[model samples]
Target chain A: MPVTSSRPVCILGLGLIGGSLLRRLAGERPAFGYNRSTATVNAAVADGYDASSDLPQTLTRAAETDAVIVLATPVTVLGPIVDAVVEHAPDCLLTDVVSVKEQVARIVAHHHPDARYVGGHPMAGTAHSGWAATDPSLFENAMWMVTTHDDTEADDWLAVADIARAAGSYVVPAAEDAHDRAAAAISHNPHVTAAVTAAVGAGESRLPLRLAAGSFRDGTRVAGTAPELQRAMLEANSVALLNTLSETIDRLVAARDRLRDHGDVAALIEAGHRARTAYEEVAAGEVEPIVGVTIGDDGWAQELRRQAHLARVWVG
Target chain B: MPVTSSRPVCILGLGLIGGSLLRRLAGERPAFGYNRSTATVNAAVADGYDASSDLPQTLTRAAETDAVIVLATPVTVLGPIVDAVVEHAPDCLLTDVVSVKEQVARIVAHHHPDARYVGGHPMAGTAHSGWAATDPSLFENAMWMVTTHDDTEADDWLAVADIARAAGSYVVPAAEDAHDRAAAAISHNPHVTAAVTAAVGAGESRLPLRLAAGSFRDGTRVAGTAPELQRAMLEANSVALLNTLSETIDRLVAARDRLRDHGDVAALIEAGHRARTAYEEVAAGEVEPIVGVTIGDDGWAQELRRQAHLARVWVG
Candidate 1:
């Protein structure tokens, strides 16, 4: 129940993730939020939630209550939001729910170097956005990645992890750089690939689209996400995404060459089949969690990251 | 409802498509099928369905009844099945529900050049296959493509289309080459691309696998389909798929280069977004169906192909 603290949680922004976070935290702790749009604020308030349009007032109240300030805006808009946090609630334990961790960490460091900040990214969302699309159960059983570094404060990490767990997520501890790379491999690159695949169908005229069925729809599903949102995440983590995208392109080239030259894609199909089997094993709970890693003990970061590399979850 | 007579329908190979087709045709017509595996044959017979392991006797019965023989096995096994059909049911009206149209068209021409043949490719299936995964409702509201060639007889074409309509699907008429090319763009190439994408995540450490969420899962869902089945479809359509696969790789390379050199993916993302939106329009019933095309009229093949090219359906 998040340590039962009276130090309220303050959320800035009320789009899908932020709005959903505000609703999810309603009974767990004293939480209030601010959105840039007054209509969304009014909508939340009319629904009996503590939402406001005044960012300064929101941060001031949060500061006075010794709150945990959560920055919940797009990566492109994080600069001004971080400046607001620096001005009014610079001393609060800070966290964020952005998609890219390293970029958010850099924004926080640039805005207020001395601010007690912990980076967070909940690996959850849908194609929809805005407060109207928000649902309190959005994070239920999702993975919320809490980033760690050599100098990160253990207490601040625990505070954010507690909230993430309270919101019905399994907290995954990762380093900022590692999280961005992993996100690029699993999320951001696939978004670009999906977009490319979808554009191919569209470019082929409507005949291909009419013949399109499950594979085309499934492979290109993420391409339907709002474009600007996709840009924010993909551009924010462009470095890691480039490497992964190139590797993926190389694999395709090899498969193409094999098909053109030898008329065989046996190696490619076999590799993919085996990989999907491994994922099924892990998803079906065949991989056991690694126990005995105390959250605050010395060398815990190394141990936890090791557990993640092996696809094992942390029990604590 | 289908030009009712004592004529029966003979299905070869009671796998997913054939088994499901046999089930779907139960009350509509007199149907019987042959499967190579006695186990599946026994299972169907025990369930009171007309299934047999004797290919010679099955084809003999089909020949005597002036049946329509549906070749439902994978493309790799189509040679032997077509040979059996030629040996016993050479005069029967023939069709197939294979994934690729032109390949089966070539096989039929090779095995029985004078046979009454109309190629079919049903654009509906789950990732799962085989007898156990058979569903009677599999083809309900699905698109079943009926192929046309220069020498195709109108009665033969209508005969196959009627059976496909009876199986509960919209009948789309396309030329043999056009159907294979369209399938390559939408289905066959996507299978190869999915294999590459899934292998990328698997090639990475288990961390990426653990972090794989919606986009990764959706993009790679078909990669989990039976590898042998994937090979059958992909290999049979290799010529057309190579062209489509090459174009897809070019798009990815361009996106990757843009991301690497200019740190910009706006062009790529917008193209994909626009394409997906276009697809949504068609799937959402926004595109009006083309009317006034009389089936089997003069120039009807050209007209229907044009309608399909414009992403319009033929109502009658």
Candidate 2:
């Protein structure tokens, strides 16, 4: 609702996140869409989206209006998307909805120094993917991580923040490297952990495996995620994930040793009980939400530090 | 119905399982309920249960009526319950509803030679515990593991099986050692692994912990379980769990190495995908139900082995 011109918002890649972003921005702004699929683009155009017949035409219209370009493609296509956008729409403000942030931010910074690109990642998704599975309310009350490098422009940051807020998310400002590390620990590392736990527990025998009912099912639900997608995310952030996973395994082995050597797993159980309690408290809205995160203001960053302390939102 | 007298079914502990068993037996047969909680005993009596004033009186009346005694208590209480039941109702066919089957089965076999005891473990329960949480439909279509040692009598086994069937469960025949091993892999091992995972994932840094939403929460729901209860279960089956956890860690490390060195995690993802498919197949009722598990026949055991292959219900 903040003051802005009538420049259109163009979203590339009609995938789940892109489609969702387009649908959620309905009526808020003039939406232009592009994708690898012609049928999908036609479907969007039929639904009243401003559709260009091709990427060149779309980029031409967007570059004319100094539009906001949202890159919603996969990780592998990120570099190419940035290069294309810089070549065709140098005046446009750019951002991304990628899972991994540091590499994307660095690549953007190197590829087009004149273009202002804010790295954005919405901390929400389901096991499903593709345009058909897009949910307009997917970002409702979700944490939308907006990352900034040393050369990030304040105006560009605010523009992306406006879109994220409009999409019904709380803006969480983090450094580029911090976002990658955090994603590894929370999303990528635990993902592999769940898969590995289920696999080893599955074992070669079937008798005990059948007994893997409620608890194992709940513990390893993420293990059923599409393999190809999981592989990309895990390997993309392998450095941080490998570190977190090694430490996690060490901690688990220690717990195992406690049980085997001393016949006591009280310490392990107690620690889990404490951590779960803390997490539940936050989930239940027992902590205040972070709102209107300031980009470059010293006092604003200080306020962010205080909020992270109170809300338990640390810089990973 | 089977040409039996008016002998009652006596449930010794009146915990969740015992209470549920008594409630389910209502109108099908006369029920005699006993528990340490005199208040719970009175509540059951008020609700039309044939409640006993005390343990000795309960046992004496049960023995006089030729009752089938079900010892439903905590793991620590199993041995004592068996001793007391044998002392009072020596002629009755007895069984138990303990979580860990092998230890309880072995203890019952060693303590009282005259009493025919069939080891029982119902693979179902909520986060709630005790008499208040009892549900008559708790075991409806649930897997009820009935364990047998060499000394177990066929008549006694069938008596327990009849009760299990009446309570609406698929009676699965397994050796005492087999039941323990299966429970360790499926139930006990996965349980501790969840707790340990949650513990490690919930380290002091709040950044990543806050980002751990659905996947982490789903993976670690068992971590929020009561500390003392988890402690007892994890400690009780430490040997099997330690072995399983070690293997799981090794597999995870292999996946980590794959991600770090070769930039591949398909092996980890594939293993998880395969295991999850196996589990989901059974869960969706794709696998045939365990029917007519043979007791002692050599060909019967062979039939069970064949059914394991056909039904895809292998030993874990």
Candidate 3:
């Protein structure tokens, strides 16, 4: 069953993530927002979001009434935010929208013994940030990855899911450590690699960069990702990031070595082609109604009849 | 002045590049195509491109009449083809459309004293290859990098430019070594890095790949590069590739270290953000109509009048 509560969700920090959530769920579900910057809070209020800059007042109101409160601040500020929430809003189910999970989970666990906490990360963002860039449909078709600490009750899980679902996101279950490792492989290392590639083009002449239109531009596009947010992710998941980058460097070295020795790079390219093809196949399969079949007027008809016994078949 | 030769060109190997060129130029410029496989040659003929399987006969026709001959084959087969062309079509202005420059230039130089050779590479291709996938507008707005060896007459330069122009490509002047180095840094290394990144994702489960839709997908999209062509490029420029790859590893290591030791990744990310912004700005500038200026009522108009004095200015 879905979490049903009359209490509004209290969103801390009205940046991109928080503002997007507020925009997505303001009318359907009541949301109160708090941000460190008073200007941003005022802007959010002006834009029709219920917002306040006073932390204690907001936390007091949330603790007294809200079903869940979302902390959408950077990782560095999370410890103090969690502590403050624990002291002031101990009754509400607390969750966070940080990129790194294990450290965030540890923070919640350390500030535990009162209110429960669930890890919630909606995997949707752009290179642009701030409240003005917020879109109500930002989370549509996005994966809202979640992890649960010991104190996370079933009701608490449902409450987080309700928030994500209200924003049109599908909740994906994840173990904290596994999530970090996967994210390092998929996100952090790719960002660093893209940055390195982009830096190669950032030289004296603008000709190469000008000529870098198609594959090079698309391939290294993520090098423009928001600096602070990326910094938070990479530093927070340092161990995993290091491991992923190391493995990738090793793979690149091997390809380079093979090219050096045999004067052949087909093996590496072929391997890449296989992986890319698999991803394409899977993505294509998601859209296809049916793949690879032959229908005849024989035993296949009997099998079809058996499968479709509940419905009448019409001859076309 | 443009090379105004009316000589019909010979295109060896009716694959992706050759077929695309033929399709683009056949209506205006005459082209005679040759391929090793009879099926491909027949397919080319069926598609309205003049082609045949007999190498000597086609080469003889091109040598007797045409001003330019384009060897559109794989790198491994380039050596024998150039040798054959030297023995058979010695007077024609020889050229080949290959990804690698230095090695192909070396091959042309070694088979010398007979036919002139100009290195031509139109940086336009897809993962798909062969005659069926050929598009007439394949090289439109693409950079056709070229290098000329000895015996490259005024007629030879224009002949090559004629073919490139016919395919709607602009000729980019490049020295063989500089071209190789720049291509290694921009094209070859990026391909290998993307391949490695894509391979990192090709594991047991499809979950990570499923979640890899945004930056991960965009960053590694070039992993689908044609295996043989990309392999030719990476292997041919292995020395440059290795140097580029090593430097990238160093940058990535530094980023990883920053994240690990100081818990700071902002510097690296900020550098990346700056580079990305510059590229975006340059790309945006390509389309914009003279940005960043203020036209004051009095002094600015007088300054503009003064600047426009060297040339005639039409009033809007």
Candidate 4:
């Protein structure tokens, strides 16, 4: 069943994604956004957003109106955000935008069973982070993976899809393990490879490296990525990441051995060529889009607009 | 000592680099330029270049002038070019613009000891090849590695540097072995890796790769490289290239192991970050410029111009 009430949407942890969501909603409806960082909240307000730094106050405001509360905190903070949301807004449908689905699902299941929680991970980011990098188009053409288990309510899944659509993503339903494995293969493994390549090259004389041309720059450019976040993700999904990393290493080592022993380097080169082509194919969306869903008329949009208006009262 | 008369500058194989050299010398002096392909000479003439398809005609032109003959053909064609130059313009300083140095040096030693051949490799190119990509700035700010053996004279080395300087590169002297090893580590190995990475990514079914963000595109963009030329370089310098490939694989495997074993991924991430920084340092020339000597005097420039003019006319 679709959400019948015009509940204002309350977004918790207004960082890059949350702030961007608030900005997008502000354009179409009144939305309440809260961040632990006072400066972040202030910056959002300065940008004319309905945001607050106080979690309890924000949650109270969300409960008074028919609003869905989205937890946009890091994985470490997700549990606390859930507890706070449940305590303050028991009547609200709760969801999260964390990358890991299993952890969020378990937390929601154990603590917020009656609070209508759904788990979502939007596959989008920029080199830049924080509220400054938040843009509505960030989610455009991005995949929003929403994972549900056997205990997940049918209505809650639909509501999660609705939110993802509103955020401008193609909502794809996947199990937790599948999502984690796929992400490990594509995102995490590549990032690690980039880092390793950079490290090895850097170990060379710093002077010669300075003269590195376009190819070196492009191959190792991602090495400058945020280490903490990458570490966290790697640690969180170590099992799947380990498998993908091992597979990549095996391929590279085999190629190296072939070249060393004067064995056929053609097959090795061909494998790399094939891998790059496959990656390009997926990136170009030449394959089917991951998420498939059709909008149910404009009813959800109208309700979202009504909720946005009520949420505006808490903005000031 | 400088040549008593202007050295004749003969260019063997009037393709991109050869034709460009001929064209640049058009109004100033005529230089002998030969091409195996009759169509190339015709195209050069159409483009106002003084060139010929006949080796004897080009050789006769070189004999009349104090010229240096540059072999700008592929590695496989360099031996024949050296033979032609040696048989015709025995006194002319013979040089080449091939990427590999050791093979060129060996051929020169065996077949053209009296021809004063200096091995040259300009570290500059575009995705596009042929006469169309031949700009005078092709060697600007680029490294031109000049390899000389015990048999090569100081005068011949200086002349090779002069030609490279005129072509807009900073000339750096290296032994044939050093040049080959450096080229394999920086250029040839990277191409193979890029091709393999692209092939792998392209083989994926996740059509999300089709949306291959900027990083993927940038990383695998070189996969479309000319396979024939790449294969030749790999085969020619297989020993050094294999060594570098082994090193790269070792680093990649180490990183994978770290991630798999739940060891510190931080070290791996840091390595990548450092590599990128080192690359930037080299590209910015903050590190010492690798190749050519700085021609700080207008006298040297004028002398080069005068010699280039005489060589061009003799060849024409």
Off by over 4 Å in 3: A1-7, A42-52, A148-152, A287-316, B1-9, B42-48, B64-67, B148-152, B202-204, B266-271, B287-316
Count of steric clashes across candidates, in order:
0, 9, 0, 68
Our model 4 lands, by Cα RMSD against the true structure, at 8.5
TM-score of chain B of 3: 0.84
Candidate 2 residue-wise lDDT, A66-169, digit = tens? 77898888777777777778778988888888888877776787788777778888888877777777788998877777765445666776778778888887
What would the per-residue lDDT of candidate 4 be over residues A1-316, giving only the tens digit for each residue? Answer: 3553234678987777777777776656558889989899889899888889888999899888757788887777676777787788887878777766666777777777676776777777654568888997777766676664555566676667667777776655556775666666556666676665565444333323522455566766666656776676666777776776677667767776776777446765655655665554445533243222223333433332222222110000
Residue A151, candidate 2: C-alpha displacement in angstroms = 6.2
TM-score of predicted chain A against the true chain A, for each candidate? 0.95, 0.88, 0.85, 0.83
How do all models score by TM-score? 0.96, 0.88, 0.82, 0.76
lDDT by residue (tens digit), candidate 1, B202-248: 64578777777888888888999999899888988999888888888
Model 2: CA > 4 A from native: A1-8, A38-53, A148-152, A291-298, A312-316, B1-8, B20-28, B38-53, B148-152, B290-298, B305-316
- Index of the highest-TM-score prediction: 1
| Model 4, residue A88: C-alpha shift (Å) | 3.2
Cα deviation in Å at residue A256, candidate 4?
1.8
Interface RMSD (Å) of candidate 4? 8.2
- Which runs in model 4 stand beyond 4 Å of their true positions? A1-26, A42-51, A63-71, A90-124, A131-176, A278-316, B1-68, B126-140, B148-159, B162-175, B199-204, B284-316
lDDT of each: 0.84, 0.73, 0.71, 0.64
Better of 1 and 4 by TM-score: 1
lDDT score for residue B130 of model 2: 69
**lDDT, candidate 3, residue B21?**
85
Query: What CAPRI-style quality would you assign to candidate 2?
Result: medium
Candidate with more favorable, higher DockQ: 1 or 3: 1
The candidates' DockQ values read 0.75, 0.56, 0.30, 0.27
